[model samples]
Target: MRANSKEQIIEAAGVVFERYGFKKTTMDDIAYAAGKGKSSLYYYFKNKEEVFEAVVAHEAEHLVNEINASINVSKPAVEKLRSYVNIRMKRFVQRGNLATALNDNFLATFSFIEKIRNNYRDIEIDMIGEIIKEGIEKNEFKPVDTNFIAEAILTCMIGFEVPLLTKSNATDESVEKINNVIDMFFYGICT
Candidate 1:
């Protein structure tokens, strides 16, 4: 099926892109990995960018799904936040190269990532915003600008992928570091 061919090419692209990054990856590289002639590959995907887009979509959607599945709204915000962070890191590692490529080529990869990010952005923000609202309503957190605070928490998550793979400290320690930074943001050191 052409759909299957598309999937194959996309997976192969993930491998090549991850190994060589966006600038270095070529259509020939993807075709070879996909076990097709470069022209045949073009028959399925217009170019490497199309293949790369497919991989990015698959990997990012997977990560968001895993994070959503792991989050338990019934739990307190603190525990929910912890689970959120854990799920995101775990999913990224599970995704490996696809994950690496997504981060590595964020600015330069297929514009598809921006589209995907835009599509998912609201859902992600709403998820965090809801929790912040609930915590405030429950008196678990002091009343503050929920939206801005939610955005702040989301901003802190920016560090998750970068440090986990590159940091000298144990992976578990990064979670501690994340928690400390989050704690400081939510509850200042004055206490």
Candidate 2:
């Protein structure tokens, strides 16, 4: 699709930010990447921070949509939970390079970015909580505190980011590890 000027600028800014991270990327770099003049970029985005915020929002929305779609399919709760973890891990592996960079620095100093991250986490937890509720209602999963379980699942998934993002290549081993975590979550570690 043909993106508008503002969308073009945001897309270009995402690329630049991913390459150089939030602090190092300049408006000029975004303008160059977008093939627009610096003034045009400024006209679209007041500054680099605005563009970066837009990028984070865009990525977060994309993730939420993907997770929702993955779980929305007609499947058992166990299947849905497994799909959720796999989809989340794959996306993290795909986008985590840039995300890790932005998170390591911007998450501490930028309250706006921090809010965006929290909002994303909240959305994820809500989605996972709904699945857990369904599982309990259907007797597929034992009755547990859905909120607590959702939060624990989210936390465990986030923990995978460190090892998954650090890998130069996401091999089958990465997929196996994520599935193993899901298995442990569902069935417990003890035989």
Encode model 1's per-residue lDDT on 76-139: one tens digit a residue.
Answer: 8766777776766555545455455546665434566666566555666777787778778888
How many clashes in each candidate?
A: 0, 0
- lDDT for each of the candidates? 0.72, 0.79
Q: What TM-score does candidate 2 reach? A: 0.88
Q: Please give, for residues 15-51, the per-residue lDDT of candidate 2 as tens digits.
A: 8888887778898899999998999877767877778
Top candidate (lDDT): 2
Q: Candidate 2 — which pairs collide?
A: none
Q: Name the top TM-score candidate.
A: 2
**Alpha-carbon RMSD of each model:** 3.3, 2.5
Instruction: Give the range where candidate 2 is weakest over 10 consecutive residues by summed lDDT.
Output: 94-103
